[model samples]
Target: MWRTIGGMLGTDLCPNNIWQYFSWCYSFLPDGEIFYTFGLAALCWAAWNCRNRTTFEFKKMRSPFDVIYVACGFITYWAGLLMGEDREAMERGAKMLRGNAANMMRICAAPGGVN
Candidate 1:
């Protein structure tokens, strides 16, 4: 499952390598960055719902695809509510982070500093 998603994203999507997954997302999802962010936010919401269902209702775990489908629905609903300026702001932030990512990585990777 992860291997296929990773292949499509051009990076590893394993739990231990989330930084790599995010890096790939930042670099590759230029046009779709806002949409991707929305999708991920919706996914988090969906996961929380699933968690509550499991803990409180004792429901069986949902399939991964089902979770994703619900997230997509949330994204669609949220996208309808998001203003154009909100999306533009998100795009600007993504571009600014992309522009400075190399410098930030260098600073974090340097010796005698926090890793």
Candidate 2:
């Protein structure tokens, strides 16, 4: 999923471990720590939901990018919790996240698309 995120962000996240992933995200995003924190929170929440649904309801997502889409929704809603520029920043980030995920989803759905 994190690799999917890097793809959305137009980077190759070839992190050897979770620590490297965290460090890279913390430094690479526009707002660095804040953006990394916000994105990670939403992604984790979405992952948790997916896990529960898969484990209890026996449902499966057709693609891993589904988590990214769900994370966008979560962050969009959570963005309201911020104030001033933080809220605006989060909204923008959410928009980008959602748009990127949507594009990826479409591409993956098309014939002979990138997987």
Candidate 3:
């Protein structure tokens, strides 16, 4: 997933280093930074919600796919509410991130992944 995102954004990010991620996004994706921020925020919120549901409601833990699905929905809905010339670019970036997330989920579900 990180590889796919880095490829799309034209950066080589360190998976364990969030500072590097932020710097890379801020530098390379200046135009689409808001979308990236929103997407990450949504992902965090979704993960928190999923954690809460699992803890309090005794619900099963959500898969990576479910979390990314929620993030994509949030990004799309939020992007739709923005008004600017860069809105299209934002949407495109969000969609690309969403697609990458889906692809990562597929890879994670494959034979050598965390079955």
Instruction: Give me the candidate number with maximum lDDT.
Output: 2
Task: Give the alpha carbon lDDT tens digit for every residue of 5-86 in model 1.
Answer: 3443455554345566566567766666556556457767877887788889999864544454455456556755667876
Deviation from native of the Cα of residue 89 in model 1, angstroms = 16
lDDT of 1 at 37: 56
RMSD to native for every prediction?
Answer: 14.6, 3.4, 3.9
Candidate order, lDDT descending: 2, 3, 1
TM-score of each: 0.53, 0.80, 0.68
Candidate 3 local lDDT, 1-115, one digit each (tens): 3565676666666455667767777777776666656756776777787778888999885465666666666767777778786667657766887777777767777577455
Candidate with more favorable, higher TM-score: 1 or 3: 3
- Report the lDDT tens digits of candidate 2 across residue range 3-68: 667775688865666688677776566455666767777888999998898899999987887788
What is the descending TM-score order?
A: 2, 3, 1
lDDT of each: 0.55, 0.78, 0.68
